[model samples]
Target: MEAVALHISNGVLNGPVSAIYGVIALVALAYCVSRGRRDLDDRLAPMAGLVAAFIFAVQMLNFPVLPGVSGHLLGGAMAALLVGPWVGALCVSVVLIVQALVFADGGVTALGANVANMALLGTAVAYLLIALLLRVLPRTPTGLGITAFVSSVFAVLAASQGFVLQYALGGTTDLEHYSLGAIAGLMAGTHLLIGIGEGLIAAVTVVTVARTRPDLVYALRGLKRPQPATAQGVAA
Candidate 1:
């Protein structure tokens, strides 16, 4: 059997559910746009574009998990750590939109669920966790990397559950062979491994940027301590 595609396809969800989610996604994105403006400036605007591009590219590559299952990078935690949550959500949403429209990676009808899962819910959960972890974790590059790794794992998990919820609400499939519990279990198990891979990528990416341009990292702002003037001068 082939692995399930990372993107949701049309008809997996009922029409009413898909339409409802579409409206929800539109409202959420409108809110993101309002809030994202505050985070966008000369430096962050370019970084947001780059983050979106990187996410779009990486999401194309899927690695095997189980025999019939595969997973790809979600980029929620990575984006949230690099850019503010509002902008991060927008970045991921843009990637999903392009993938669905241009690449046909996800069904156009299922675009709402996809956006709600990977973009809004995943990014929000990751950013919140990152914020909480940063409060206690060391204010250093290593700490931020660790935080990203841990948060990415949960972000994927959370996004998986979002699918489960939608399916429960209005799944078009028969429930005789596959129970909701079974579906949830499979999604959670497969996505847990995928999350680990995502976490590693997020950790490495965040650490690299934090070391070089800490200023560009939204999560590091006000959290990362200023390096000693002499140390900065020497590094420069």
Candidate 2:
């Protein structure tokens, strides 16, 4: 905890007044869209809640580098891969907001920036990458694994670059020790390695869904798994 605080003190990631407000506005938009269709089976609600809580738990484990410079799995891609993007974003954002308001892990002032980095950037980038890879890779479990792996890796790196950009646009710290270029490259590179872990988790989860409950692996279905009644009526 103190170590994280020290890292924050040493880190040069700050947003400008205008960008901060813009981030807040975007978060509000996302929050509004996050109602997530209550008509859907309520059982999924518990699944989503559990997934969010598990991600939060993993995030707290922060693997360290020299006791400070470390990366943690924020579960942006994992959530999106498990559920859909809208639900995934809402899950991560909820977790982040709670951390800020209740735990004081991220804080309210910079809450938007944190969301932009972890939830928005991470999920958006990962989704795009996976979509592209799916187009090229064979529609098989191996292909799913490969695509999930690469996308997860780059998404983390892109989030790091996003931070560098955000800070460069409105940074409050002296970036001499960690120049924008160096920071971007180092963080991205480290995240690329971390993505390996993300990739494996995503791949395993997808394959599990594919084998067990095909309805849950929406991405692979090529269509929304319509409710059972719809499928039964169509069959009849």
Best by TM-score: 1
Model 1 pairs whose backbones collide: none
Per-residue lDDT of 1-236 in model 2, one digit per residue for the tens? 35243112212444464356446638654563554553135655676787689777877766644344566776777776666566666678788878877776765666666677777778888778767776776555566667667777777777777767777777776756877788788877777766666667667766665556655554555333343443321122
Name the lDDT of candidate 1.
Answer: 0.89
Candidate 1 residue lDDT tens string, 1-236: 54335689999999999999999999999999999998899989999999999998888778887796778999999999999899999999999999888877789999999999999999989988998998887757878889999999999999999999999999998789888999999899999999998999899988888888887889867346565454431133
List lDDT for all candidates, in order.
Answer: 0.89, 0.64
The worst-scoring run of ten residues by lDDT in candidate 2 lies at: 3-12
Residue pairs with colliding backbones in model 2 are none
TM-score of 2: 0.77
Best by lDDT: 1
Off by over 4 Å in 2: 5-15, 18-43, 64-69, 222-236
lDDT score for candidate 2 against the true structure: 0.64
